[model samples]
Target chain A: MSVKQQELEKSWQQYKTQQRKKNLYYAFLTVLSVVVFLAIWEAVVRFQLVNVRHLPAPTVIFQTFIEKLHSTVPDGNTLGQNVIASLQVSLTGFFFAVLIGVPLGLLMGWFEPFDSFVRPLFELLRPVPPIAWIPVVVVFLGIGLKAKATIIFLTVFVSCVINSYAGIKLTSRTHINLMKTFGAGTWETFFKVGVPSAMPMVFTGLRVSIGSAWSTLVAAEMLAAKAGLGYMLQVGRGVGDARIVVLAMVTIAALGATLSALLNTLEAHTLKWKEMR
Target chain B: MENIAEKNIDTRPIKVEVKNLTKSFGDLLVLDNLNFNIRQNEFVCVVGPTGCGKTTFLNCLTRILEPTSGDLLINGESADPKKHNLSFVFQEPSIFPWATVEKNIACGLEVKRVPKDEIERRVDRILDLMGLRDVRKAYPKDLSVSTAQRVIIGRSFAMQPDLLLMDEPYGQMDIKMRYYLEDEVIRLWKELGSTVVFITHNIEEAVYLAERVLILSNKPAGIKEEVIIDLPHPRDITDPKFIEYRNYITDQIKWW
Candidate 1:
């Protein structure tokens, strides 16, 4: 290569290396903070700074985590069984919420007649918390997966509809006009122009909803479940074992985080056409 | 240049007939009884004062706005997208941010339900013409303003619309880019032979690109004068005759 061309290539390589180093530094900071926090927690418990009865040492929590995998001593079911049960209900509820809520929200945003019919009842439900349905849920679905899933679905469904509605409502007027100039019909424009424009916000809603699915799943199980992380937490409390409670809380957090990370990957892939700026 | 006077006698069929068109926003009358006729394959540029209802007139012609009174007929029938293929490239930004350059260019054809093969064929031709082949898969956010405008123009011409309305499509560009894009437009108009109504406040842009220049008066606007630009293709802006027409139109806009 010519000297100038080689210099330009070398500079570009340097810039890329700088960016890589910056990303590595940030990742290191994240791991360091977590390690420091865990070390502090272990030290506090070992020195009896906090009561071992309340805040168990990290090693004690790890030991309980290992035992819960095989034994069902304190709680009625093992950790593996509880996790599977929770996944079944939450995923079923979340899947249906996405299928129904996204289209309903898009339709409501574009069609005035449909919005007029569905919005008032939706508004009424929006103000009521999803937990409020538990009493009615117990009465009808009778403390089964249906009841827990229903609770998770209601909590997630509202945000999905709200975000999707607002996303479509904010579809640019210029885009609609451009489509009109092309001879597009109303429904055609909605699918072509409106839906794609709404996606970034639609994804924002989905991330928020998935988080809701997990939090609401936990709350529902705490009250009425026989075999989930939240149920184990409740039973641990009833029998006074802090290790089991900590294990369940940690598992709930880890699973919630993993699901959200998976969704982040999906968002990046689907919105590849999106403006990074 | 004088041959254009002889060329004036040539009869081309009328493509756009604006009949006593007027538009009002409640008490505000923006377009007042404007009337004009544009021949088939004509490149007409309209120069008007800022906010002198240039956009309003174009919107009314496209029926994007309900004209307060009178009719806009294309090929002697009411202007309708279904009846006559129509396209607009306004001052607003181009391309759906979520769509690639190729997809954005193909959108008008897709809306017209053009067959898959034909859409690809036409889009390929436009990508070459508009110099967008390199960035066909790139999103608008990755492009410069000039390239994005070309993508918009490419999309408009891909449909081969019977009438194309462009309202300052290159308004945001710098002078060199604007001139370059204007020449590109002139070349495209010749190759495609679609009737174009190009609205701009830039008088020299009108001189550069138009076969006919229609100057509009200030708000409560009407067509004030019609000047035929008899200059030849690749006309130099520094040419004396070019300056004369530009100055004359500038004077009319200033006076009116």
Candidate 2:
């Protein structure tokens, strides 16, 4: 290559390297912040700055976590069992919500008659909290995993519907016009222009729906789940064992964060064409 | 309803006919008995006094609005998007950001369900002609606005529609880019052999790009005059005859 061409290639390599380094630095900073925060908590506990009875050290929580992984102990189920129970219930409800809500939302937004028919009912129920439906679910599903899952489904379904609906509403008129001029049928226009245009918002709804799943998971499990993190929390509270309570909290937080991270990865892949974050 | 792609190709002497087209918004008359005809395989530009119901006329032609009276006919059939192969390039770039340069150009073809091999062939040819081959796989977000506009124009042309309507597509571009785009359009029109109706406010642009210019009168509008440009291929903008035609059209526009 000519010298100028070589220079450009060299600069491009440098730019990539610089970008990689920047990302690594940000990651390192995040790790450092969490580590520093954990150290302070450990110090406070060790020095008796806080009541040990009320709050446990990170080491104690970690030991309890390890023990709970293998032993059911007071909660009558192991950590793995509780996690599995929680995942099954939450994911069932969450997936059902997405399946029913997303298409419902898309159709409602696109078809005027559908929107007219569904809007009144949707708006009427939107304000009532999902937890308020726990009694209704219990009456129907009898407080088993089914009842718990139904509660989560309710919590998640609204956001999925609302976001995807708004996303479709945000579909560009220019695009629809373009499709019409191209002699596209209504269905063709909806799939090609309306659906793709609504995706970013749909994904936004998905993220919101996933979050609602976790937030409602605990409450749903509290409605008499035999094995779940939320059940463990209630049992720990009943027996005045703050350690198990904190353990359940930590596990839930960690699992929720992991799911959120996975969702973020999916969003990045799907919306690669979106300009800027 | 017939699918445009599957429709047996039918050619009529006049590709488009506007017969006493009238449009009124409640009581305000926007278009008043507009009448015109665009011949098959012809390039026609429509110029009018600003806000002379030009957009209403276009909207009527595209069936975006129901005209108060009269009708537009394409190939001896009532104008319907599903019944005829038609393409439109809007005043602004309307490229789909989700699609790549190649997919964006192939959108019209895909809509009409053209054969996959045929779609690919036409897309590649247009991508080369439009100088979009290098960025064929790149999405619209990564491209410049002008590049995005090229994708739009390329898409409209790639369909090789029976009728192509463009509404001031270069309105937002600089004069230099506008001229470049205008030349590309003229070349595409010549090669694709589609009847084109371009709407522009610029008299010079109408003169430069059109074989026939239909100048419209002030609001409550109708065609004022028809100026058929009798110039050689690749006509010089700086040529004396070209300037004379431009001046004459400009005067006609002012009078209207």
Candidate 3:
């Protein structure tokens, strides 16, 4: 029986290896397809199928990205500086939203009084887009870092609050009962069982909120701003610098994808125990 | 019926007493004016039809559910779980999935704040007893159903409670594993001299493990009969007395 068990384990390992290889093959094809699409865009631009003034080739955008890296503007800022600026503002807003949203969501999920009283207010405010709040924010705070941060914060806050509450609500009923049987008091059960169980869902909310907060950067930057990737894109559009605009768009996509991947890793690490289940 | 038995048993040193224990949820009554007496170190098996309040009796004993109107006494006083060493092994596997077999077995000790060295000693002994030494570090999800059930049993037995409550704990196991675990429970109970309240729908199981068997009626459950088994430890399943009692209880349960 032991020998048979070893053989079965070996065969399972081999099966997993084959599955991984197949997945990698598919992933390679996906990358190849993306490359092919980019090549077509380059071919169209090189052959002057579309005016260079309107749409730059991949090579033009790549050069623009490199040039912006080396060239500092009047305020001692380069393209990298602009990217960092946008990230700082956006992340600041996102963090504030997380700080406020998580507790509010927990209260809404765990307590009937808060759910009844505060949830309605949140629902009423949630439907209004974050960008729509920009006019009022600008009127109060003006076009500065604070105004941009406020917009991003509001954008992420609604989604985070909704997701966090959902996460808490989705906690397993069995877990709570088990704790109760163990003689755990109400507060102890909430901390030991409810919070840990809801963590995965809360992380999901954070992921969605982070994505939305990043998305609002470009919109926030479209308004009056001195230095940010969004401001750079705005400047490029003003001067008809299609190469710079393309570079900004590519940077935004890359940043969004990278941040999302990082959050996925964090979620996986925090939920390692769930993997066994 | 249990109430009749309750009246017959002298109450001088009763460990637990149930008086007019009636329970109802909404319009449905599950337990009706039930009464029973459990002495210290006695092993009692409650056999009943589905939804016949066997589980409800155990719940009331543990104070998990409030009795609609009843008095539950432990040691001639009101039963308070916090003050008593009482533990329950649920019908399904209730081993904490978050903890390994060893850690799960040690949970009550940890909750009760037993010394570290003592916990380690007792955990090792229980793991050995359950034949789970090899899977000490294995989580519940990684173990087979039989192995997981052992973890639950081992955990409760580790607590060495004054009264151990088991609710159809071996219902999910195969025959061999079930008998083995039942014997293991008997061994532990004998060693600790703890009172036990075991609930099962299986008539054979009640006869095999219980000192006294209490049969309950179907929905709107009332105790139907009680029988005392005088057989010695490691009872012969085919013994004439065993077969006689088994048949009599089977008839009572089936007809009622």
Interface DockQ per candidate: 0.73, 0.66, 0.31
The C-alpha stretches of model 3 lying farther than 4 A from their native spots are A1-52, A72-76, B1-13, B115-118, B191-193, B236-240
Better of 1 and 2 by lDDT: 1
User: What is the TM-score of chain A, computed separately for every candidate?
Assistant: 0.94, 0.97, 0.89
Clashes of each: 0, 0, 0
Worst 10 residues of 3 chain B by lDDT: B1-10
Using TM-score as the measure, what is the rank order of every candidate, best first? 1, 2, 3
Candidates in descending lDDT order:
1, 2, 3
lDDT of 3 at A6: 100
Q: Interface Cα RMSD per model, in Å?
A: 1.1, 1.0, 2.5
Range of the 10 consecutive residues with the lowest summed lDDT in candidate 1 chain B = B1-10
Query: Which ten residues in a row are the worst by lDDT in model 2 chain A?
Result: A177-186
The Cα local distance difference test for each model comes to 0.90, 0.88, 0.83
User: Worst 10-residue stretch by lDDT in candidate 3 chain A?
Assistant: A174-183
Candidate 1 — which residues are off by over 4 angstroms?
A1-18, B1-7
TM-score for each predicted model, relative to the true structure: 0.95, 0.95, 0.86
Best by DockQ: 1
lDDT score of residue B37 within candidate 2: 85
Model 2 residue pairs with clashes: none
Worst 10 residues of 2 chain B by lDDT: B1-10
Cα lDDT of model 3 by residue, B1-256, tens digit: 3443455553436788889999999889988988888888899999988877888888887778889998888787777666666788887556666567888888777766689999999999888888999999876767888888888888888888767889999887889998898898899888767789999999888899998998898878888877877678888889988898789888888844
